[model samples]
Target: MKNKRLIQKRRELKLTQKQVALAIEISQSMLSLAESGDRTLDDANKIKLAKFYRVTVEWLFFEEFYD
Candidate 1:
C-alpha cells in the first residue's frame, strides 16, 4: 500500500515532505506515513494532494487501473 506514486510525484515536483505537508496543512509526519503506507489518507486529504500535485485522484491513488 506504499504510495510510491505519491513519492515519485513529490520528487518529480522537487518537493520535500515538509513542503507538501505545509502546503496541504498537514503534519510532515502524517505525509511521511502516507508515503510509507503506514496510514491511508482521508478522502479530503487525497483530493487535496491530487490538486496540489495537479494529478487526478485516480492517477494519484489508483494507478493500477491506469496500468
Candidate 2:
C-alpha cells in the first residue's frame, strides 16, 4: 500500500527490481518484500529510495498520481 508509488516510479523509469535494489544498496529480495508490502523501509532505505528516485521523501511515500 504505502510503497505503491515507488513501484510505479520504478516502472516508469523502466527499471527492474534488481536495478533498483542495486541503486538502493539492497537485495532484490528486499526490494520484492517492500513492493509486496511485506516490509517497510527503514530510515536509511527511505533516504536511499528518495535519492535514487529523485523525488522528495514525502512525495515518494504519500503523493498520489494518476496512472
Candidate 3:
C-alpha cells in the first residue's frame, strides 16, 4: 500500500520531495517510488525518514509494510 501518512506529513510540513529526499540522503525518485508504493524503503532509509519526519518507524511503516 502507498505510504499515505508519509505523503501527508510531507505535505503538512510543506516539504518538497527533493527537500525530504536530500535530508534523508535518498534520491527524489526513490522517495517518490516509496511514497507511491512502487518500491520499498530499506531499513536505513526508513530510519532516516522517520527521524527526519519526527515520527516513529512503526508510525511510518505501519503493519509490517517494508518492515
Candidate maximizing lDDT: 1
lDDT of 1 by residue, 3-64 (tens): 88999999999999999999999999999999998998899999999999999999998878
Ranking by TM-score: 1, 3, 2
* Runs of candidate 1 exceeding 4 Å displacement: none
- For residue 34, give model 1's deviation from the true position in Å: 0.6
- TM-score of model 3 (CA atoms): 0.89
Arranged by lDDT, best first: 1, 3, 2
lDDT of each: 0.94, 0.84, 0.90
Q: Which stretches of candidate 2 lie over 4 Å from their true place?
A: 63-67
List TM-score per model, in order: 0.93, 0.83, 0.89
> Candidate 2: lDDT over CA atoms?
0.84
lDDT of 1: 0.94
Tens digit of per-residue lDDT, candidate 2, span 11-61: 999999999998878999988888877888788898899898898888886
Report residue 10 deviation for candidate 2 (angstroms): 0.4
- Tens-place lDDT per residue, model 3, 1-67, is 7888889899999999999999888999999999999999999999999999899989887946544
